[model samples]
Target chain A: MEFNASLIGQAITFAILVWFTMKFVWPPLTRMMDERAARIADGLAAADRAKQDLANAEKASADRLREAKQQAAELIAQAEKRAAQIVDEAKDQAKVEGDRLVKGAQSEIEQQVQSAREVLRQQVADLAVAGAEKILKQEIDAARHADLLASIKAEL
Target chain B: MAAEQSATDYIVHHLTHAGLVPKTGAIFNFSNMHLDTFWVALALGFLFAGLFGYVARKATSGVPGRLQNFVELIVEMVDTQIKDAFHGKSRVIGPLALTIFVWVFLMNAMDFLPVDLLPAIAQAIGYYGFGHDPHHVYLRVVPTADVNQTFALSLSVLIIIIGFSIKAKGLLGWFKELLTAPFHAEGLGMQIVLGPVNLAFQIIELLAKPISLSLRLFGNMYAGELIFILIALLPWWINWVLGTPWAIFHILVVTLQAFVFMMLTIVYLSMAVEDH
Candidate 1:
């Protein structure tokens, strides 16, 4: 318990220990802690970036879906318009064909009627000549009867 | 019991140091080297350094082993304490505090071993190996309980304080502060008159720092050691009944004393570095 010189030895030892610890022990530990903190911060920042990327991708996909829907609608409208145009073209062709057929048939009928009229007129003229001849009970000159026949024909 | 043996002899025998006698008129006689104190203190210091050094060498950025975790916890604790108490930036103070705390705690913890254990072993070695008388063998295992040991630690802190003070304030400024601080007179004549008074007060204040610091730890540990020795004097069975509870209580004292020593050193150094 008495004061003695061993105090110096202890002091020197203490000083050496302090020096050793200051040089070796403390810096590494503090540095490690700082590094850990920095790493954690970096990780958090990366996570935030990933989250933002996910959101941006979601928005881009949504926009593409909306644009595709609009394009599909336009295509459907164009198809419908083309279908209507095809139907109208078919109707016009049918009408034109019907008009042509009707015209042709009318012309043929007119020709047939003409032919029948001609036959009828010929018969009528012959009948008139016969009647005149029977009444007179004599043969009339054929050249002189020509005017009567022509007149009969005109009247018919 | 031997015819010469008494309670006073027993206590004196326990208190004596085993060391070489200081040479007469030696300038370095102020440093009386105690073999027991040096050996115990150095051994414990090495233990602390080795453990911490191993941890430092194997330290990883990933999940740590149990030993690494424990070492890191201690490092963090001491770091936090230094941050809290020390106002100025110091590269040395953190490790210094750690060393002081751990070293002192280890020294003080030596008290928990049965009082006669090491001494008996030492006495046996001296008697059988060296052919020395067993009764002449002296060994005090608890280094911090020795005044010289505690004072050595405190005196080192005192040196740092002075060095820091001088560094913070120039030599002239530090001298002037020692002369005129904590008391000053308005007039030049009055100041001259009060110079010695202020210097005396300053010297006492400076000297008191180490004395109180060392004595506080030395006193507590010494008393604890004495109590253990007294308990040891009792019959073996009765010794357990008293020693167990005392040892448990002394555990707090051991840790607290170490904490006080480290805290005070930091505070003193902080004050030294600060202006005015």
Candidate 2:
């Protein structure tokens, strides 16, 4: 109730407490709080970046997969086309070989026919000459008969 | 009416301070000290400063524990109040407001203890431990109930306010504002005439801040403590009927007084910084 020296005491106490608080308490707490806020913001931004990277990687992998599928499809188509070309080439080769064989056999047959005709013509001429000599009843005029025989062979 | 004299004596005993007694004829003495108020307030101040210091030392930017959250809640609350009220920049104002609010609040909270608990214990120690007369041992636990304590805190605020005014505006500027403020004049002669008037008003205003600040907290806590003492004087069985309600109401009074003291301090400082 009375005004006393305790007032001064309390005032000194108050001042010292305030000084202690200013020096030790307020700055560190506020600094820590601000730092914590910044850290949280950084963490959130990092998370967002990670998510974006994941999406980008997913898109890149999808593109690579699509490209591989296209390449595989192109390779399969080329293989099929190559296989078809090989089959066509084999068929054409077989046909050409058969034609050659047929042609060769035909030529041989034609040659044989020509030789037989010559042999038949020679026999016919010999027979004809013999028959004429028999009819003329002599080996007279053999030189004149040779010229006739040559003309007959030419006609055959 | 049989218990009337004893009732008065009991109330006076509870109201008395455990400190140096003034000389017989002197009504106001500077040598007298309220040791109970001094020790209690000092201890509470240390408790506040110590705990907050501990928290600051271990404070992490990572996830906070419950205790850290609680401390942060209070610190942020005080910070918000300061930021709202104080426009000027000063490092002292924040810590000043925190100390006033927390220290005063702790002081006020001392009123919640049973009115005679500490006194009785002290009396027992004096009687048995020291072989002293128990009747002479007086202890008033709540420091804010003391006018000296509240006045001390508010006067400290007053000093700080003056310091802030001087810092915000230099000494010449502060003095000039004091002499020319709240009433402006066109000519130098007119201004000179109004200067003394303004100075008178300024002194009154300066004195009023501390007077009001100290008295408001002192009155509330003092009245509350008195009421508690009165309630203890009632029959033990029926004490709760009035005690419970008064205690509940006093809780609001205690917190509101502390908050008012802090807010007024910040407002006054802000006002000191601004021109008329």
Candidate 3:
């Protein structure tokens, strides 16, 4: 049997191609893929960081809103307390003023009454003295006149 | 009687590999030696590597020359093919894809060399130097034309795929995948039939890998070599006229075969990663 040289030659060459290509070719190829994987991981980390930042912002905003709401309530309560205090002070001042006005009116009325009484007493005395002088044209006892005046005053 | 005996003898000899016949098992058959496979593949590998290096070194980064642009284009093509075929976290497949493309391309490109060039040179070297007969020297440059070489490549790819399958999915998990994947059917009766059917499909699929891989390469290269040999048989002057045209056209054929082989490898690796 004549075995062809071509078949033998072709077979030998193919084996080497497989050997070197596997050794040299596959390593660097895998490296590039690893780099790509690292890039994806970095991307995922960035996404995670962004999510965390968003959550932090949300929490911060909620805290601020709660604080603002609490302050608003406190401000409303303060305003109510101040208004009540002002109203109570005004009412107390009004009561004191009314009491003072009443006291002043009473004192003024007493003074006027005292002055009128004194004037009336002086007029009655003058009228009594004039009548006694007319009746007593002739000489009369001063003691007897005084006693009669006292009796008239007591009877009136 | 002599004619029938010669014909039978020819078929048996044709089947025998030109190697150091070993006296042992498949693993111990290191006696099957094929040196031309190494030499031609090495020669072409150096030739391609040199060409790429020379072109790249001479490139002006500002605006690439035609050769530089062409090299970049080839790289991009290889890279894009890699991206399309493999998925998830792969740290080894990209450069493997490129190397596969370049190595096979170089091997295939050997077909463009006058089918007689290396053999002619070997004959000359011996005829003049050692005074050995020119008729004794024989060499074939293309590797894929050899079925053994193609099968070797397929077997290597098979091992890698199996290795990754084991690595990505543990041994137990991978085995479980065979039992349960692609929709589960309940009950003892269904399991009895479907399990073996599924196992058989898996086996067939695995077997097809080397068969298809080897055959595809072998068919293309064997045809190309046959055509070149037929062309060489024409009158010497006429040989150049017809052979040169085919040689130029075959540049495309060789490159396409290499591309196909590499793409298929990537596809196989992609499949290995999938659960089904």
- Best candidate according to TM-score: 2
Q: Which ten residues in a row have the lowest lDDT in candidate 1 chain A?
A: A133-142
The list of candidate 2 runs beyond 4 A from truth reads: A97-156, B1-5, B22-27
Give lDDT: candidate 2, residue B248.
94
Query: Model 3, chain B: what is the TM-score?
Result: 0.80
- Among residues 3 or more apart in sequence or in different chains, the pairs in candidate 3 whose N, CA or C atoms overlap within 3 Å are A12-B37, A13-B37, A29-B95, A30-B91, A30-B92
Error of 3 at B59 (Å): 9.4
CAPRI-style grade of the A/B interface in model 1: acceptable
Write the residue-wise lDDT of candidate 2 on B1-276 in tens digits. Answer: 115448888888888898887334355679789999999998999899999999999999899988888888878888999899889888888888888888889999999999989998988998899987776788899999998899999998899889989998999999998999878888999999999999999999999999999999999999999999989988889999999999999899989999999999999999999877
lDDT of 2 at B199: 93
Q: Compared with the true structure, what per-residue lDDT tens digits does model 1 show for residues A1-156?
A: 456678777888998888888877777877776676688889899999999999999999999999999999999999999999999999999999999999999988898888888888778767766777677655667687778767876786
Computed on C-alphas against the true complex, the DockQ of each candidate is 0.34, 0.56, 0.05
Interface RMSD of 3: 8.1
Ordering by TM-score: 2, 1, 3
TM-score of each: 0.79, 0.84, 0.57
Candidate ranking (DockQ, best to worst)? 2, 1, 3
State the weakest 10-residue window (summed lDDT) of model 2 chain B: B20-29
